[model samples]
Target: MTIYTVTSRSISARWSRYVGAHSYRFSATSNAAMGQPAFVIFNNRFVLGTVSSLLPATLYNVKVEVLDGDGNVLAEAQTQQLTAPDVPLNINAYSKTSSSITVNWSAIPKATGYVLKAKAGSSIIQTIVNDSSGTLTGLQPYTLYTISVQSSNAGGNSQPSPPVETRTVLAAPVIHSFSPNFKTIMVNLEPVSQAVKYSFIIIRSDAVGNKIKKTITSTNVTFTDLDPGTWYTIKAHALDANGIPGDDKIKEQVTIPCSPNDIKIQEIHSGNLTVSWSASPLSDYYTTFVKRDDGLEVMCNTSLRSCYFQSECGFIYFISVFSYNKVGQSPPGNVLNYTTAPCCPMQVKDLYVSSDTIEVKWNPARGAEMYETKAQDVSSAVFCNDTSTICTLSGLKCNTIYNITIYSYSDIRGFNYSCQKKSITTGPCSPSILTITKVNPSTINVLWQQNNRDAMYKVFAFGKAGVRSCNSSGNSCEIANLPCGATFSVSAVATTPGGKSLPSYSLPVETAPCCPNSFSVTQITQSMTNVSWTAAIGAQSYTTLLESYKGQAKCHTGETHCLLGCITCSTYYTVSLSAISETGLMSMCNYQGYSSSGCCPSAVKLYRLGSNALRVYWHATAGSVNYIVNVTSDNGNFTCSPMSGYTYCDISEIYCGDIYTVIVSPVSIDGSMVMFCPMKMYSVSCSMNSGAMVIYRGKRSLFHNKA
Candidate 1:
């Protein structure tokens, strides 16, 4: 018997069954004789079937027989897939730039190799047998490509794979972001890969869209030195390993302006009255300049640009500068100026001219150095002969008339001009005699011969004494109020219609002291003297000073004047005195402290009646004075002075109308002695003056009012 197996259920490929039959040397005739069961395996499962003898070349239905120790039919199973003649693999179409693609199916199992189809536009081109993956070289970047694949077998050629699309790299890089006006931009490259190197090209554009390149750098870039308030654009892209680039690019359009439009100018410190306003521009600066108060102006760049003005306490000026660039200057900056100290016309000083070559000298002005001088006739026709501060007149007429004026000038800009400041005429070239004399301790007289009928005299007296002057047309003049004993040199200038006469010199004059230059009789206390004044301005000190026909001594020799003492109510006197100046210049006062006046100080007096009795009284008309009496009639002694004090006393045995003298004094130690007003008396008349003037009596009669 032989075993049988089924490899196919039917000629269909959708659902298939493969059955195997197990038999012990079984014969085909037994399959039809006994209706025997058979064991078979189909598609990894077992099934029971009836067997039949089938031809090898033709399709057959068969099964296997099974005994006790052999296989027996238990169940039935089937397969879902079946195959007939394995198809060869092929590539119908694929992405040309891709490395691998799908292989198509067709033909029978006996095929040896497959073919890959490459389509060029509308035509089929190259073919490969052993590989399904295909690669094409020298292809354009970013170009579309199509391809297909097929197999070759013993039966025939197979169908090709489905058409596929792919792309090739593009040729040149395209710029994305390059903003010149913005000064910065973000660059994003397409197809980012290590195989590709990127670069950025930034350019400044002209008005006509022409490229003005600043630099070529990396893909990410930053640019500076940009102008504000301008418009620009940016472009960017990527590059491939083959020096080829993708066509993808990006751009950004914008404007740049981080700062203000115009420039700002201001002054930091205007030092002097000249008003130094610095031409400082705030933002954009190209140049600077300053304009003068005069129509003139000075460039800040010029070495002589700075100028000075004779500015008084309060004044103002206008100024400005323009900020510029290659295109043009920005808007003209605002005009501004500082309020400077006012400009005062300088005063004329030392206006004297010399006849010897007419050399003239004077003092400098406060803020001015240059000065103009005119030595000419009253008519403007002499303009050509005029000169400046140190000028000389060659043909000046010696006897003719001329006038002069001088002016001082100053400037705030680089260049400055002079103005006429002060002037004085030259002498007539003739010598004139002059004499200075002392009029009194406080007066001085200057005498000079007249130059002409119209000439004037200008006398200047200067020395260690001080500055003094006396101007007159007469031959003789005096300067009063001068400190006595002062030595002063006098210069007399005689002038006529033409000019001044030759200056005449006079010997220094010194005042004399027959009296005091400074004197006072000020009353310190009632009837008290207190006199003081600065030692004579130029006086010699005196050791002995006389007043009231009485002499008193000052401590040192330099004492000019001082109070003598509390004097009597009578005419006193003053005397000439002397002292020394701080410079040791000695001077004397011809005057002295004034005489005492009867401004009416009260007066007092007294009389002595006899021994042991006296009377005292006062000036009943003015300031009252108390009167008291104390006497030792034997010697005419008393503690009271002037015989005037508080009380009058009576003693027994004192003779009335007796010839007894007494010293009169006051109650206080400082009270006047008999020297104040000597008065003597002796008697017993002790009592208040207003009370009574009666003789003493016994104790009982003392109460009887001395009646």
Candidate 2:
């Protein structure tokens, strides 16, 4: 590669004799001359180099000549034209699954097509590329990958791109959690000539796709709780599926493997597997895992340094750890064990099984890159691992047990076989946690107990309610247009990378009845009433109750004279009063048709006739058959008596001078005064009819006193 340059200083270190002349040559720049070129020497003293990096691929003309002996051209050399460079390399990526990874790169600008390849060690992980992109299916978590692309044309070949790299896609992030200190992994892709976009995916080890994984356009991505000490490969490729290079292909780059301490299990319920460890001495390593014997893979990267592996009902699992970087995988760390046993489990101390997969973990053999694990179902047995323990074995019949063997390894490349450890068998998975959640008034969200290797969410609507199915990460669903207050039946199951979970169901759940709003009462007749309410939202017709009362005070008071499915203004109600809705939640007002109005003049009393004593009597405005009379004097003299019919009372104890008072009120069937009027007083009157006598209608008698 040549660079553009102007001669800076060309004082010859030592002069050499010109081939065919006695003259010698020297070089210098015009700027360095202080004011101008020290001497006029066209092609000899002022030598300039072409700027290759700055030169565009467009046409450029070049001329060359050789100066011999003196500052003069001795011979003309070659003239050349520069052409634009072929399109660089193109690259892109996608996922065959949550665990598998795919990547593609553009063919060389002048080449026929592209050839794709991936390397972990010297071992080619994947190779083949009639197409630009190729999938590396079923990769292990926390593994580093060296990805590359070379350009080819009929002319033979151009140089290969600086090694492009990518980590296999990491297992999805574990635990859908929100916290303040969550670690964010920032992936930096190499700078290319053009501004291009890319697609990325983040999956938790035990989860289905996030159901909402965000596609980041920026080169750097922030992921929380990555598997520590484990190498995670997040692929970056051009947005074009054809891997078409726009102008310059971006150099593929994988994330630096996180430290093992950063990878950990966040939580566990059945809590069969969760890996927690302190920071290791190594900086180039990152990854933590709870390997299931059930053929499920689990890994996490986070500072809290933990990973979760859920135990199914009959399955078992254990944990293993390793840290690594670009150069190579590190020795394996300590192994931890756990299990989910059913009935009588003999392998519990060393192993566990979930469905067909069985997992086993033991104390780490020092210096192991990982442990080699194997499983034998009722049928077939296979060994798969360069270096790793806690292997998952599959292909067993449902609910059946199988034997397992484990071995220790020093280096995956060096130690290819398993060492000795105890043997065990597999078991079945636990019943999925079928939870019903209300997402909205019209929708339900169903989910199951958490598992690292979970795959899909299945919902079953069955029985008298008929049957239906919906797939989602949310375990629950919204059943729309269901009759309010109607009973419904439902069941849910969870699918995992290892196997399927058991189904759980809800007891006859029922929808709530709608309660009416805007309740009101109207007088139908002098003696009748009507009540009404508005329709409740998202529910059956509003339930209404009516009550009749005699005053401005609302007749509601939780009383109802009539029960209404639907009431218009003219609904002639019997004044029935009752509570409404499932919970009887109601407004403050009662059905006024049946409830009484504020008592009118609770008690009425007549003024005094004389000063010595007073009498009290009253009458209710409504139905009443009897009354009562009580009398008290200002001097504290008091009396009481039962009275009927006529609403008046008179007491005798006439005195020449003294204030007296009287009260009159009505009584009810309960013998309590339905209406009461307050007492009034009058100074002793000389005449008992003083007030009435003043209103005498007849003309005063002017004639002589008749006998």
Candidate 3:
């Protein structure tokens, strides 16, 4: 007989067919064991049989026999020295990575070693191990694998166990770059092999339980709403369809620094400026940036909270602060706006001055937004404000010296620059209430209210002759040598060391005219008189007036001589003369003239006295001391004498019935006289016994009889 197949638990063998064989029997026995071997029986038609009760990897002897109807053996076959191990069971694959896998199986009986095979995409890898489990290596990442295990001994090898199918994990993701901001952080990763998604986590290093998680299909991820100036740990991993994770990539990052607070200006000087701010967390240093309106920029870096830089006056500066570290610079902190103090005003000049107002001008100051000027004196203080170079101050004391100061302002609060103190003197005040105190024929005295105690005064007189002026230390002054008969405008002015004032209110004054000389009156008549005088200086006309008891007369002329008419006869008269000037001022002559009557007498009368006595009467005459009367008749001539101081005269020794001539005459104190008579016939009746007579003169008859 010959052996065909052998197993760890059993053995089979075959032989040639026997002739006329009813059945077959097979038997196998181990050569090293002392126990009986196993056997098997078959039918007459069979030629093969397997032996039972065999040991694994043990030497065995197998025999087959053929028999006739019931008695003895016809033929027999025999085989020896055949052995095999049992098959492995329960095969599995676990712990899969990107390039490797671990496999395990149940151990077979009497097996000395194991053999593992891994297959993927028509390629197979074999490995021999003495243990039940082994790892498969040198495989592609993220690939499917089919794995199997087999038992082996020194005699022979058994069949493999059932196959197990699995796939390796995906490759780990690689970190590429990191981006950080004040409040956010972003992570970028390299692509992973066979990765369907990625998982990311960020944890704050300074805080407990502060973390963020995300899963995405892309390789980049960003975490937001984070604190500034903070440190964070980042992790990223690739994932498979089964949610299996690969190796992780880890990194550390930091956000930018936090913004600074409470920016301030510490100090400012002519050429330097200092700035400060509150500190920022996690910042190594601070930076201050300054920008000017004129396109100039500067910066200062410091580890402290404050910084200093060069500065200039009158410039607008924009300032900002930033926190910085080795990682990066943070966003700018609070922005500050500032301006330096301006320079003082220069080149001060006086523009105008009045009694109570003063105007001043100066050069423009750099960085100055407003200007203030102050004028101070012993008695008053005044101020002016302006945006430009010129300023006007009012309500100032006149004729006084004032100290001046100028201040300049800028954007810096409560700060101003000032210049050197200066001095200015105001003009003297104008005199008021001008008055002409005294006036003479050739001079005028003027007075005014004094505005300043220490000032000098000047009085001016303007007339037809010309302008005349007078100066005095007091308020009153006299203008001498003024022309007569002229009206003048007078004014007063005050002067000091500062300046002269305007003229005061004007007053009009007039001077009197001089009297005329050599005044006389001659050629006096009953109806007219003559008057003459020497011309007076500045005389325009002459006036003559005559006065009498009966009548009076007046005359006016431009010449020195004039006549007075309408004089009464035999009457006393008085006369006067006056000189008139062009301004209607008059001055009378000092002399006067008087005239007495120098005319003849008038009116005559005759009367008859008893018998031998007769009387005649006539009117009296001025300046005649005595009178004489003459009576004439055809029979005789007669003479008569009048009483003293009386205008009547008596005639005696008359003849009756005689033709007579009657006449009357006046004698002066100078003793020169004249008379005239007319002849007339008078009728007289005489009676010797009765003692009575009647007389006739002219057309009247007079008779007287003794009783």
Candidate 4:
């Protein structure tokens, strides 16, 4: 075998020595920094050497001969065993999924295939590929892989490349949830990769190829300013550390519509309110807004064109409407103002009356802001207006009726009053008392006080005589020509337009009794007289009042015949007899009288007539028809009518040694005049047998002389 000595450069050249091909050619290149040359022959044998430019651990076949310049082989040698190539350079692993991994490296010279080994701690996997990049299947998700690559030939394997610690791509990000509104789309995903960022691609289904893209460092993203009532397709992916994207997922959602338009109020009533509006084409339901001027508001939802809500009486409110869907609420529609009617007022109550006044009270009516009270009479009318529910009316006529009415009104609703009529009357006062101011023997006068000026009075005089009356419009009245010693009862009354008041309490009056006109002495004697007079009418009794030289004297009697006994002769007497009525009325009658002239008896004496009798006598006067003798003392009086037709009379039944007054009166024939004898004091000292007491004393003296 021989080696070549000279070398030349050629782009296309013919071969001089050949081991297999007939037109084969060879060329060699060397590294300048290694300072090694090629194509040098030595030691008389042509040596075919391995240069450093050739691939490591590779086999080459060469042809050697002694030919001068012919393309022929005399001696030849070829290697059958191929060696492994050098280790792969710059190995990297990326783009991991839940079940697969992708590895890449710089290609090695003379390498037939590559052996890729992926290790996660104790777990390992191996694969072979004839290319610079390989993907390993059936790998764990979201796991760290210690990856290495080696070049291999038919002979053996090269040293393993520098071990590269890289994590398989985290599992593909899962789409958790998504939502689409009128202006925005929100997306949420579960992280399946160890990725620090995510990318969202939102594409409208209606607008093909129109997409909205955004990148965020979190697992959630939101795309805004999208069309309303539109459907969108969303795609989300988690990016790796090398800025490569994993498998992405898709989800679909739609947005809501805008607000409804042209809202209007249909009707407003005391209990309910109705509202209607134009329905929105993209809305699913409607919401009505009802609000009052007093800061009250309410909301209700329905799918119909009109909606009803309960309304408060006498309140003014603003109405509006809106449309909404599952996404969100919409803007409100045009607003309208509404008002309700006021309710009726309650009836009047607690009606009462006082002296010359009336009081009216009532309950408050619903939705009433003010009230008016009117009271009307036949002569006048009164009105009161205020916010209160009570009123008082004054200055009314006594015992008069008045009509009352109340009116209720409000600002929101006009005046509406439904009330019943009421009537009340004032009461009258009491009348005054009747009195008697003057009275006389035959006339009576009466007077009374008047409470009311238009009152009437009546006076009546009664008792003993009869009844008498007189009426007067004034406070005073006079009843004339009434009997004396008469009594009267009186009363008064007052009247008005309503009714007559009760009569006043009765009063009593009396007149004086009349005096007696005639008085006379009918019969008279020396010692006594019988008197008589004309009796006054209505006199209960008569008193005989006398004034004489002896003293004044008074006597009361009910009989017409009176006795004035024991009169002194030649003495003048002034006597008055007064009459008293049952009512204490009094009057008097006067008279004058003197005792009659008569001869009185002279001396009177007494003598013993017998054992049971006494003799009394006196000198009789010439005018006496017979001498009337009497024996009188503190014991009793005893008289003899004619003294036995003698000037003396004997008195019997007299006790001896007892004193007595003997009287003798001279009597007239008509029993009108009498004369009184001088009374004598006498005693019977001895009996008819006077010697009996002398013998009794002489016998005692004789017995004493003998003893």
Candidate 5:
């Protein structure tokens, strides 16, 4: 016999008796039957079957017997225990939280209460409830939970429904910090337990309640593309795996203003600097910071785009600008630099020339640290410190005109403003007077008082030798090769810076005459002598001087010969020739000459006898050979010897008381008579003695010649 379990509520009865017997009986029984059984028959075989009430999902025991001609047991079987319901079908969990969850499932037919279980990794939680849906409390936030549901009716709990995975809602994120840029907001969220993602929301503080929302996987979120200078609120929350958000946290912030543009340095003075910039659209005010490399930093704020401040003198400053609003400050804009200029001096004065230097002076300016000076035509420039207001420029040309410019300067800025330039000409001083310092036979020494301004000098000597010039830097010069004994219009003109001066007091100078080149006894005769010599330069005339009382003679200029007449023979004399200048300056040369001895004797005497004789008388003649006399009227010649120093001689052979002619002559030692004749005389004497004409014949001769 076999027994089978039924899946559904359906029954059919069939029984078999012993093989060919008609009218047989069959019986069956069950341990889990609830009521008595009934037998029924339909065909030939006798079958006993009953409809029994059985408990669902319950195990039961059953027995069946076959009677052959009597009541006897044939077969018996029993079934194992059976289950009534499986784990609840189609289990679902909803509304998950950190520590609790809601579960739901299909209903069980006989269930009296439901048990739901939720698990994370090892922790489990369970609850019993009569309704199909129930909630579990006290669950962790942002935690994963596996949930299940069961339906029960005293048959024991059904197998737990297939596990349904669910995660609890995460705790809301707390806003830790929120920052705003010009047009963006950044929100940092506090970590939440078991959170998967964070959501950030930005809302504007305006009437329209404008808002922006963003989600990110990290703990922080950034919202971009916002308005500048706008106030907003940032809200942050954590989300679970199922995209459900937890509690939210909020933070308030405002964006920064826009940065300023086009920064510029407007004006710079000796002690101040001005700066300006373009205004920003969203800015309420502007702020500036100024600094120099070696100075302190300065900051100021203003509603306008420009600002001015006291600054260091001649300093270079770096300037930066920023825009500011009620919320925050913007980034710095473009940076710029400015420098202050130096001031100029007030006045220039005291410009003069001293020696070879040019001196200039000035009054200092308010902020001048140094001074600069330059000449208009010169390339070099002069620098002076602020301590001194005067500058001396040396090594300048004398008697020159100069244009000078002066200015004050800062140490770093060089020249700034300049005084009016001045023009001046140097005055030239007078040279010393010229004088004839020395004299020579042919040259004169000329000198003048020395002067620093002298360049050259001209000496004009007025003499027989015309004019001449001399150039010198010193005080003295020579008028050379001048005529002797010549007077000069010696005047010197010095060339100076102011041109040449008037000739220095027309000096009159004379050079001593030169001695004759030569003088000697040229020739000596009894009557005359000749002298010759060379003429001296610049000599106007020549003079022959005989110291021994010979003679005085002169030769005109350019004459070199002189003659002396009537010189005594064999005489010793000092002869000198001299050169005389037109100015009466004289130079002499000595010479010796002798006049030639006389050839004929002077003062010869002649005596005559009447018709009887004559006599010649004469003195002795030097250098004469003899003396001779002649008579006329039948008288003979008479002769005298020079050796006798004879002065007279008797005449004879002439008739008594007769007229006679006679003459006398001197003869030179060479027998050449001088041919000079003495006066002739007649020798005639008639003397009448005491006897008269009666005895005339006897006393004839005695009458004519009276002794």
Candidate 6:
């Protein structure tokens, strides 16, 4: 019998046909086991038989026998031990690369060779090798492949080892081009085959090992945030589905030079400006540009870090700098805004003059920082500085022509521009030290000092009555028609052809009082008189004086009336009334009057004619034409008059045990009565026969009894 096929569990064999045979029986046994062999019986005329239940990759002894129906051997055929090899164990695919995969498995004892099968999608590939390991070539990159290894000898290939799932690494990407700028770089690459993603790494060539890495699903990638004016090395690779990286593709590139930094102004002159800046790396040269406010441009190029350009004065400019190399020019650096120094100032206009000050104005300069004004005369010079177009120069000589100059200044040193000299005349100086030389009841004289001798002066007096003015060419002037008893603010102003000067410091003055009018005196008592007059226009108070050969008396009052007391009786007096002003000026008016005799009835003699009647007699007053007596008591009051030319009076109904007060008034020939005269007292007493007795008392007795 000849063995046909052997497997891990079964074996098949072919044998020659037995003549006149009944059937054939086949048996299989393991060489390592001491068990009965597995047998199979075949029918007559069978030439092929198979044995079941056989161990895989084991030495199996197979025998086929031709037998008759009686179970006796007619002929037999048996061979040596033969079996198929065991299945390969621990199958693995490793060392995977783009378009290649290596499959490996445990070696089978006495195996002739090993076969590797690799399948991807619907495509399959087989490779044969004498060793236990085999490689599959020309496979797709980054593809998932299932692989298996089988050991083969005289037996057909054992069951393929357990399948191994693996994927090939992606291919390396190709760099197509690089885009470089001042601060960034973009890299372009060819697409890798079967790549799920791509990886990139960038390293600065001049720096100390700073690596930037990125992974993306796209083939084209750009590296951002890179340093300018630097050389870099970029690497790119593809990754498989398992995240395994392929070989790297590397390239080198250089970015454009960076912009110049930290621009500064070195020097500024009347017609030129010099600027500098910090140097930029990888730059071969630098260029500076300047643009004026009027749309004019100027540029300078240099290999160094600084440059200079011609400029116009009194102009504004915008400036910038850029670095350049063989690649291109970098972006412009920070822009600089600059203003040139000012030129000479324009014509001065709007010149205004006052007493001691001159205001000067001019058209504005293009770039002036401040303006200055100077005024100079024969005796003095004044100066003013201001940022605006106008300035004032003060404390200048009055009524004088001054040479005025305006200057425009800038922040730059030694760049002050001056205008042409201008001539201006100031107004007259104000009159000073005002004084009132003389003050009258209705007029005043004023004097002042002034430097402008050729100037005309006007003196003004401001009062409650009205404003009064006087004009004079001299230093003194008199103002007339001033109201009396009024205070006036007096000042002086000087005027010339230029203008009027400011008013001088004011001085306060008061006019003298007017004389009192309508002075009169009226007798109030024998010793007192009422002096009255019309109110004076400027009088603050009134004073009355009464002078006689015997003595003198005076009284003062603020009203129109004053009372003069303590006059000598029956004496003539000169009554003088003066109206006094607030400034102690006075005017007087006089009147003559005669004082009356004492109001009491002096040297009185009383006669009792009847029990209720009494006769009274007294000395006559000098100015009296008639006399009247007033008697007062607790019971009642009574009055009696004497004859027209007499001074004696009679009292009727004199009562007993009663005290009486008697006042005697003198009536002048004009029929004016003088009251408040001295009083006399009398007491009436009753006698034993009922007769009334009259007792006379003096003026002191009347006052003592009333007190």
Strongest candidate by TM-score: 6
Q: What is the C-alpha RMSD of each candidate to the true structure, in Å?
A: 23.8, 37.3, 28.5, 26.0, 28.0, 17.3
Model 1 lDDT per residue over 415-495, tens place: 122334333444555435555566666777776665455566777777676878777766777777775556677677766
TM-scores of all predicted structures = 0.25, 0.26, 0.39, 0.36, 0.32, 0.43
The 10-residue segment with the lowest total lDDT in model 6: 698-707
Q: Write the per-residue lDDT of candidate 3 for residues 8-81, one digit (tens) a residue.
A: 66777677777788887778777788876677778877776777567777877677767667946778777674
- The pairs that clash in candidate 3 are 1-77, 1-78, 22-44, 23-44, 314-367
Q: Write the per-residue lDDT of candidate 4 for residues 360-427, one digit (tens) a residue.
A: 77777766788777778897888888888888777766656677777777886666555556776554
Provide the global lDDT of candidate 1 against the true structure: 0.43
Q: lDDT by residue for model 6 over 578-686, one digit each (tens)?
A: 8898778887766666554444445555545566766666776555446777788887777888887775677787776677777776665465555666667787665
Candidate 2 has what TM-score? 0.26
Q: How good is model 5 by TM-score?
A: 0.32
**CA shift at 119, candidate 1, in angstroms?**
58
Q: Which of 1 and 3 is the better model by TM-score?
A: 3
Q: Give residue 360's lDDT in candidate 6 (0 to 100).
A: 76
What ranking emerges by TM-score with the best candidate at the front?
6, 3, 4, 5, 2, 1
lDDT on C-alpha atoms for all candidate structures: 0.43, 0.43, 0.74, 0.63, 0.61, 0.77
lDDT tens per residue, model 5, 335-382: 777755544544665466643457778766555677776655454433
Candidate 1 TM-score, true structure as reference: 0.25
Q: List the residue pairs that clash in candidate 6.
A: 8-56, 57-84, 57-85, 57-86
